[model samples]
Target: MPYNFDDEMIDEIREKNDIVDVISEYVDLTRTGSNYKGICPFHNEKTPSFMVSPNKQIFHCFGCGEGGNVITFIMKHLNMDFVDTLNLLASRVNIDIETKKTKRNKELEDRNKLLFNINKDSAKYFYENLQNNKKALSYIRERGIDESVIKSYGLGYALPDWSGLLEYLLHKGYKIKDIHSLGLIIQRKDKSGYFDRFRDRIIFPIINNRGSVVGFGGRIIEKNGQPKYLNSSDSPIFNKGYNLYGINILKKYARGKDVILVEGYMDVISLYKYGIRSSVASLGTSLTENQVKLIKRYGKDVYLCYDSDEAGKKATNRALEILKKEDVEAKVIVLKDAKDPDEFINKFGLERFYETMSNALPYMDFKIQLYKERHDLNISEGRIDFIKEIVTELKKIKSPVERDVYLDKISKETKVSKDSIKEELKYLPIRNYKDKYINKNNRDNNKDRIKPVINRLEPGYTIAEKNLLYLICKDKNIYESVKTQISPEDFITEEYKKIAERLYEYYENEEFLFKTFEKVLNDNLIGTLENIYNTQINIDASQKNKVLEDFIKTVKIKKLENKKVALKERLKEIDLMDSKSEGDVEKFKSICLQLINIDKELKLHQ
Candidate 1:
């Protein structure tokens, strides 16, 4: 059965969830006019092209062409699946979602729960193994790690017996089927019973970015095992690429500070030992897109403190390439050539590593220094090659003044002319300063870009519509004043109708918070609200009535004009049907005349 979503519910949601408030949590929105504008988080746009319409309960970005309601915004911003978005919002609104009794959602939900349950139980079991398990005491002491450090990271151990964990879990009333579902144990091919997946290993729990244990990584203790390390396979809840080793563990320390990005889990632990609290490991995979966003949400800057050996350099360069796209500052620590952070700390101790971090160069400066060492500066062509290489790196920088400063530094290093470097800068594909200078912004250009399309309405009509929605959304009296005489359905744009529909349904709940609407409105409507919020308009008392009347009239005119066109198209359709009876033809003509009369009545000025 289809769950009916009434217009009143939509209105209630919109009134409860203001687009600006919802958007502001994820983005930095600055008030523009009737709406708020910000850099579109959806796409790479330096200029603020994304707008949120509090009035329309929608958001739209001109850059990416994404327009939607609060629900859609949550779906896009959070990267949540649609059902997740629905459930998340439903929970917020105190509305219950009808469970999909279908096999698929049920299977997926159950699989996730089982995986979650396994991770939970496995974490407790692993921690117990670490504590007072006689078999793992030698493994713990060999690392020279104090017991406190072990406990702080929740370090754990896996028992030696092949069926130890499996047997215990079964005794706890977890079915063998459910144990298999958790991916903690595999099916036995040669034997009748199941066995433990990981045996006699030192375990490091893999927690999700949300701080929930989703998987585990195990390091072998016994010399007999050829593979030194093994990580859990992907199940319903975990993707290794998306999961970093210490993001969940070290996020609070990273927040409001620069994070130390090291290569391995031990490097992260070693840094913490050295009083460098803001460090995390990439969990044996390259730093991924999901990882970048996760870090950015926590820390404002990232210090790539990967190894200094050849392999480490390669990893560092690749990390720099990926992290640069996130619009945050990143610096690479080249670890003084001989060893990794752990090796350096073990040899020279913590002071040396802290000095290295302090002396770290900006990534572009480091890239220039790297290429400079490759070419002989004395040779003219070699110097030119070096200049070209460094210039390419420098040109990638968005800030022009910063680019020029580096260009000067290169001029000193390579003896390349500063003017020559500036001339080379012209060819780089970057937005020039004048193009993005927004303050004291030109009225015509800004207004020209802002006009709503009543289906592309001109700036003036957009202003009128924006003001009307603002009034209707924030004040009930304004909504009631127009509700009897004006219909938002008469407004041709889908965005207008959505606002009207919400208003028609809502206007009654006194305790509603407009910010809560993002929970329930669809993405499309959220986007529309964002755009309406972007448009400049007056929702003030003196201009409210006049603007409302003008907007209502414009919508009515558009509606009537469309109706007339439909009538004309209907007559042409009748002509095409040769089998039409004489009575039927007469009736069609009469109905067309009545439609024309109704259209004329609709267009009357308020």
Candidate 2:
């Protein structure tokens, strides 16, 4: 049996959990007039466009058109299904839900829970092992990590002996196949038995945003080890690309401040220990787009604090491009005479590290300075090339004021005339000012303009459908009255038709809460519906009935017109045939009669 939640139970869970409190955990929202606003977690934008209404228990993003109630938000944000999201909320509010689970589902769920327990037990085993292992303990202490930091990060050590974790998990009643699936134990080559995956290493458990120990990162105690670090392979629950090392702990500290993005696990732990708690690191991988968006959910600003080596510089450049795509503000931290944050903080006191962070350069400034250093600007050719590059970068700046400021800076630096740079900018190719993350799909579509099939529907039809849906969402009476007069087929757009059908179902049940309807809608539909609901169509109370009537009439006329055009096209094909059968003639006559009837209907509506 599948888990089924009654409407009343869902309603009770939603009523107990406030939307503002739930959303605030993921989005940094601030009160804006009657509603709270924050950067949308769905899409990247600089200005705050995501709005949450406390009174309505709904949220809407004006920028990306994402809107929905509390359940919808959690489902989309965490990428969980309806039942899982409901269970999570129910647990939060201390409501016990009677879930119907099949034998297979129950087995899988039990296995997953056991995996979590195994990881927890493994972490504790490693922690106790660290207390006994003097070499690993001394190595961590030498790296400036204290006992408090060790306990806070759950630092541990794997014993030198093989089959340590294997024996422990097996003693705890975990099967070899299950432990192998978790990447904690490996099957022997000879098919004899299993052995521990981690041995003679310092262990750092990788926790997810939900505070679950999903994976682990290990550092070798001996200096002769070939690889300095080893991370858990991809498993059922953890993907290195999606999980950050310290984000579970960082979120609370990064609420209102910019996030400090470092490169390694030690850097994050060390920074957190030294009072800089808003820091996280990618787990043995390059910074990914998913990681950047994860950071965006916590804060708008990101400071790149990777190592100062050439590889680190390249990594920073790659990260900046991805962050720019998401419209996140990025800055580069260049430490003097230090390779990374750990060494910098260790070499100089915490105050010096804070000073360097405070004086971090904006991405563009850092890029320009890097370019200047690469080229010999003393020569005329080199100077001209530098100026052209600066102008190209300046064009990417969306704001005219910001562009002018950078242009003036370039003019002073290179002794180039501002007018000359401005003239060069005019001849350069036009660039789309929209955020690349949101505009990427549209850009791809534009490249396929030669495709024969295109959206040929009139804009007026879409407007009419949207307006009617908006009006219906605003007032339940409007929805109830309109559903009886017009079916969902009357709507031209598929999205609008879906919205209409869902709204009709809700009102038909006499359920007035919009949050109840949110359970059935996905993220995209929720955003679009929220967009429609939030749009203010100012019609006087006395004129709302007339406006709604006119909108319905417009949609009906558009539908009839579409049918007329389609019928005429079919008639043309019929006329072009060499020989017409009696059936074809009868079909033509039928179409003509239907067209006449549709014309009369349209006339009456008009």
Candidate with best lDDT? 2
- Scored by lDDT, model 1 comes in at 0.67
**Tens digits of per-residue lDDT for model 1 on 397-445?**
8787887788879889888789987777566554322222122234335
lDDT by residue for model 2 over 426-532, one digit each (tens)? Answer: 88765432222223345455664543322232354566688888766544546766887799878888888888888877666542333345557766687577556
Q: Could you tell me every candidate's TM-score relative to the true structure?
A: 0.52, 0.54
Tell me the deviation in Å of residue 145 in model 2.
Answer: 1.7
Off by over 4 Å in 2: 1-108, 187-193, 384-392, 430-606
What is the clash count for each candidate, in the order shown?
Answer: 42, 2
